[model samples]
Target: MPTEDHQAFVNELVQEHGQRLRSFLARRLHGAGADLPDLVQEVYLRLLRIPDVQTIRSPRAYLFTVAIHVLHQHRLNLASSPEAVDIAEALPMLQARSGDNPAEQVEAWDRLEGFYEVLGELPPKTYAVFVLHRQYGYSREEIASQLGLSYAMVKKHLAQALVHCRRRLDAME
Candidate 1:
């Protein structure tokens, strides 16, 4: 099919069924479906990448088929993921043992809040890069390979995470 025709076809498919497809993913993904927009975008990107949209006799079938593949991959990624450490819980242990006072407690809580705020601001993929690189000690190349991303993308994510963390921590000071 011509590029314009193929684009129009994909656009029409999305316009017609995007909501249904998103709900399908949300049902399957549960909590992880918070990134439903990104997942939906990935489905669209995959559909657009097809060399010949004509080959897909049924666009609905093709759309759902791609969505299922995306969801399956999502499950696989989660299954392979390492458990993240709960730093908020662990922060108290690192504090000065003698200072069981209110002021010290507040300081620790503020620190934990700052940490979580920074982490919460990141996209799930960017947060994954931070944890994989900082907590799990994976090299950039390894992270890229495992996540099926480019090395440069890994670096960009890591940098954004670091910058955000630094700014948040600085504000906490």
Candidate 2:
């Protein structure tokens, strides 16, 4: 298909069936449905990567097939990783530990917020590797497979992220 025609076809599919697509993912994701947007985006990204959208005779069926694959991958990520506390969920626990003092609570919140801010400043791939390994407990091999990086490159990005974070944290003090 011509590029313009393929794009129009895909856009029409999204406009017509986006809600059903989201519902399908949300059902499979269980309570992890907060990631609905990301999963949806992943499905579209995979669709865009296909060299010949014309070969897909049934676009809606193909779209759902892609969503199922994405969901399976998402489950694999969650299952393979150890129990991991999302940082947003952890912030309240940190506040509780800092006690009832308003000033201490504020300071604790500020520090955690600042730490995440520093993380956000890293290069995108580096940040992803660090989060998948440290925050989600993914093995380097798994991260390399998922992110399409070499195992050595995953290690490199992770190390760079750590060093960058450490320097920023020390400077913050």
Candidate 3:
């Protein structure tokens, strides 16, 4: 059960920030075909469900923090489920049809595969930071707090990982 004050606080926060939140989600989820407004509403609902969350000083930051976690979980859930192979089959055709030479296309795919492989080889913590910051558009501060790491440490890990990825891809060419 939520307290009346907490409920009221949430209501006010939603009213103030709802549009901004929707826009944030829309940019992040561009072309995903998901309903950005619904996702923003879900984040608010989750915030309401969290015990004593109203005690936080900056509720807007807390909302974004929760929203990031919710988005990550949603993506993981979707990845775990088996899906149709239509997209997979069409990917090569799409790539080939794009205005590029055959060799350039192959090299591009190879570099991408190498990048994924290098990412997999990274330590879990480093890889999480890299993915959150690079793939998911999280800021260094947000990644540091979410992973319980220092900002400097996150920066170091990300820089080293990027260097390694670039080196690996260059070596392949």
Candidate 4:
């Protein structure tokens, strides 16, 4: 395709299906709407790279197919990042152990209340990252994706949450 033609074709596709494409990606990503814009851009970039858009019989289907591929690649990239595992391992400090006796259970309950108080004091995003990862078993990368934060930011939030909880809980003892 000529340069002008290719641009026009790509622009037309974006104009027609951009909103639906974004909605599709947002749903597939499981509320990771933060990455929607980037993912949509990637899909269009891929579409532009196709040597012959004319060869496609079904443009809407083709567009969604490209979106699915982008989503798959995104998941693969997130899965291959190894740093999330290391940070996740360091989070064992946040896990509460089971109490074997009534006195210990009472102490555990007290500590749990203190922990909730500390969580409430956190900035909303930090608290979300901490709870989603620790309580809900989401990986750091997943939290980063869902929350639209960088991986380092997610790690920092988790660390801050941990430190704050520890200090506050210790004081409660």
How do the residues 100-120 of candidate 4 rate in per-residue lDDT, one tens digit apiece? 565665565446445545555
lDDT of 1 by residue, 1-173 (tens): 33897789888997999888888778666578577888898888888789888776557756876776665456445645665311101011123332546676556544543564456566656767776777567899988887778999989988998898788778777
The better-scoring model by lDDT among 1 and 4 is: 4
Tens-digit lDDT string for candidate 2 (104-157)? 765765675566557656665675677678766889998888777899999999
Models sorted by lDDT, best on top: 2, 4, 1, 3
Q: Which stretches of candidate 4 lie over 4 Å from their true place?
A: 83-173
Task: State in Å the error of residue 159, model 3.
Answer: 11
The most accurate candidate by lDDT is 2
Off by over 4 Å in 2: 84-173
* Deviation (Å) of 162 in candidate 1: 45
Per-residue alpha-carbon lDDT of model 3 for 1-173, expressed as tens digits?
76787688788878887777777566555365475666777787887787776467557656655665555455444433455111000000112232336566555544543455555456556656677777667889987887677899989988987888778768866
Lowest summed lDDT over 10 consecutive residues: which window, candidate 1? 85-94
Backbone clashes in model 4, listed as residue pairs: none
How much is the lDDT of residue 80 in candidate 3?
34
Report the Cα lDDT for residue 16, model 3: 86
Clashing pairs in 2: none
The best candidate in terms of TM-score: 3
Candidates 2 and 4, the one with greater lDDT: 2
- CA lDDT, every prediction? 0.67, 0.70, 0.61, 0.68
